[model samples]
Target chain A: MKRTEIRLAGEGGQGLILAGIILAEAAAVYDGANAVQTQSYGPESRGGASKAEVIISEDEIDYPKVNRPDILLVMSQLAHDKYIGDLRPGGTLIADTSNVTPRAPEGARVFELPLTDISVNTTGRAIAANIVALGALVAATGVVSKDAIEKAVAARVPAGTVEVNLRALNAGMEVVRRPATGSGDAH
Target chain B: MVGAGGVRLMQGNEACVEGALAAGLRFFAGYPITPSTEIAELLAERLPQVGGAFIQMEDELASMGAVVGASLAGLKAMTATSGPGFSLKQENIGFAALAEVPCVIVDVQRVGPSTGMPTSPAQGDVMQARWGTHGDHPTVAFTPWSVSETFSLTVTCFNVAEELRTPVILLLDEVIGHMREKVVLPPPEAVTVVDRKKPAVPPGEGYSAYDPGDGDIPPLAAFGDGYRFHVTGLLHDRSGFPTNDPEEAAYLLNRICEKVERRRARLTMIESRDVHGADVVVVAYGCTARPASRAVRMAREAGIRAGLVRLITLWPFPREDVARLTAGARRILVPEMNLGQIVHEVESAVAGRIPVVHLGKVGGVLMTPEEIFEAVKGV
Candidate 1:
């Protein structure tokens, strides 16, 4: 199988790092594929450009960073502005509509959804925005199976918050299943 | 014993803790630092459950000192830190080396001079790790690149330290320390654990702590085991007492280096990929090896004769194995996170036999595969 590079970029407190780990685990552990997850952030624990990258392939993965992401998930305007150009030609872009004004790249399938709003409406927790983003990513791109990601989320998230996080995840899938706002399937 | 035996996703730092525990690490004293703090955090929670001890020392100096003290009490002990903290521990690390205390010091390398970049990866500490502590000493530093290799290499670090009765270093970069991957963990019983040899003679029955007795390693007794023997940083004689005689000091120093240096056959480890007759061999360690390996594969795909030599054991400088592996290559390329640290070692090791190319990078950034492949293609 061809290698799939995914980049999740947002503020540090958005929990995107844990989301990346879960997504990689879904592919590598449950799906029985090779996946490597890496992240880079500022020294502070919050309010900086944070990114978590995952490379999934059928064979051994090398060159762990995501130079050109096949799928780019951006949660905030700063992340979207800095990383929108990094989306590969004919790649998939999933942006949070409420926070980002994405100028969709050419020949890309862009799904601009209200990710933070979905999390707040579904789970009554704003921190589940990352989980909602993951759900949208799996639903729109089909890179990782819903079943595998569900198992990963169940295994990785805190026990008490699992139900709310899963609710947020399914709500994310729901938005894509419905007609996404500003959705362009140019691919 | 931390969890049931199965395949799981883990980070390099967390895996180090599990490997140390499997290797019978019973006591840990460390100051938390970025890129290496996860080991201390996890060990703090897990050690007490296993009836082991964990202490967050006041500083890296105290942490290293405590590790030495604990190991002298006969428990397999360890301390971990990043480059800044690693510098502070050098004095005690040297003392442990001369005194022959069995302990493990883990340095998760970050860009350094004086905290050049916190939480960023760099391989700048290669020379410092080997010759960091004052004076001449043999170093056994294990550099593991991947998450799974981090586990096995950490186990080997403990075993080598215990068997040889010396301090061992587990060197890691920030990338490998923070990177997470799928690792199939082995059961606790499957791992081979080694304990330091103890004195055959009773405490008072003419037992000399530093006497090698025709062997390089003397059977050392724990401090409180009814055996009272001297251990000092000054040159010592066979009876463990400080000796002013030049011959006795030379004997002590020579034996200490020989004990570790002579075990090169057992201590050296490298992973060579497709270097039998390759034209260019890329030599790298720690986090840099990931891209180096990828570059080799890319070069091969592009019909270029490129290979990789991932040096696992960095200290005692595996020159022989390096020379042997890259003998067929026309040129050697070393890409380090530091500005030409390991490149010099390679240049000296090859000794102009193979034309060596140096590619050094800094600034808390990684050498991408494209850049490394370009270096290979340029040759």
Candidate 2:
């Protein structure tokens, strides 16, 4: 992409900040592209809204903040309700069906998946939900190669849990490949 | 040139540690504060592995004091802090300035007059970095807009501090300090490393610690070295003894000021683009330069002759360059996170020849490119 802005929004303690850093690393380190990752958090550590913005481009990124996100991935209802209005006209909204009820604006494409459920079922823990969401984000937007994301995850996650996180990532991609009955298009 | 080479994604605070290590920094003492705590945490982890020392002091005062002590013992030392901590460090910073101790102080600024916002960005320390100390002393401050620049400028701050024998400030805001980006650092051997000038005279060979005959900077001798000399905050003569005479005190203070002021031309660093024939010039630094650059591009695309001057070296403020850049422009726009700190300097430089506008944002939110574009169009 010439220049693409991505926003990952969720409540604190969901690892959205780590997900954002991994995505930016995937593009900048593994994909040989330029990327900048910035994050904002509420005063309280947990339960409050947390947002991470990543801007990727083939050239230098001028403005670091995401004014209009081309892709928005949200895992909480509050994040979805707050950030859905900031998506560009033809942007793509990817939300976790387990928590967020999809409310796509006009000309916006919506994709829903059970990101947290898949992580809990595949890895027996909900901590890897952010990695699952990252896998889906890569598959849907093609922002970075799958190999790049996998390498970034391997380098970022703590040792002894890399396998489980990788499994969670692949499970997420599998869900995108086979959409559920009521789920919208994986576009 | 001696680091883990090639391209890697790193945060700004991490880059500062890497840069300090590359500059042969052997000692670090700091107190943890938001937006700047990462630098201390990483240094604590990395310094010991590199055969250096790192100390987490009880507070900012002790941190600065420890850094100064370590520097006097002939190690390149550093400390990092944010708003409140920076305020606490002024006295010791002034001590370093008056005592002619070479050290680097990184102030990763957060929103505040007094604990305003912890995790937010602000350039409010621009004035403090220059004049926070009580007495009149020369100041050298450098600011970077990106992660890679942070690495290079951190090294530069060390070099300048050593060469000039004074404290240097690497000013950063929360936005640049917290952001992550890709950077390709040069090999250790490829980077220029500067060490302080050591004493040439042997012990008891009429060696005076404060004596620099024809030069403003005296050769510093390590404390434990055979060449024993005194160091104090009081104004002293070339023999290293405190002076009560007004003439001797004035000479000592003027020597400190002249040491840096005489080298201002070499110390100033600025990046100017398309400033030759522009109708408006945007002057910005630190994180605000990122959006100011975008605004300049947008204005140019819309057929407005807008140029940009990004100050990489903030203190020893680039007055000559600012005057030359705005000579042909009708107006100048300064967008800072603080309420008109740097704008006042720009106005003084322009001397009312051009209408200088200050676009100040103090709410912890960065000034957006759209806002700057509108300001450019209005100008």
**Residue pair clashes in candidate 1:** none
lDDT of 2 by residue, B162-272 (tens): 999999999989999999988898889988999999988787788887898767899999988888788889888888889999988999899999999899999999999
Model 1 iRMS: 3.4
* lDDT (Cα, tens digit) per residue for candidate 1, span B242-287: 8899999988889889998899988999889999889999998888
Q: Which stretches of candidate 2 lie over 4 Å from their true place?
A: A183-187, B1-5
C-alpha DockQ of every model: 0.56, 0.59
**lDDT by residue for model 1 over A1-187, one digit each (tens)?**
9999999998989999999999998988888788899999989899988999999999888777899999999998999999999899999999887688889887988888889877887877788999999988999988888988988998889879878888888888878887554542222
Q: TM-score for all predictions? A: 0.97, 0.98
Worst 10 residues of 1 chain A by lDDT: A178-187
Q: Compute the lDDT of residue B248 as modeled in candidate 1.
A: 93
Supply the DockQ value of model 1: 0.56
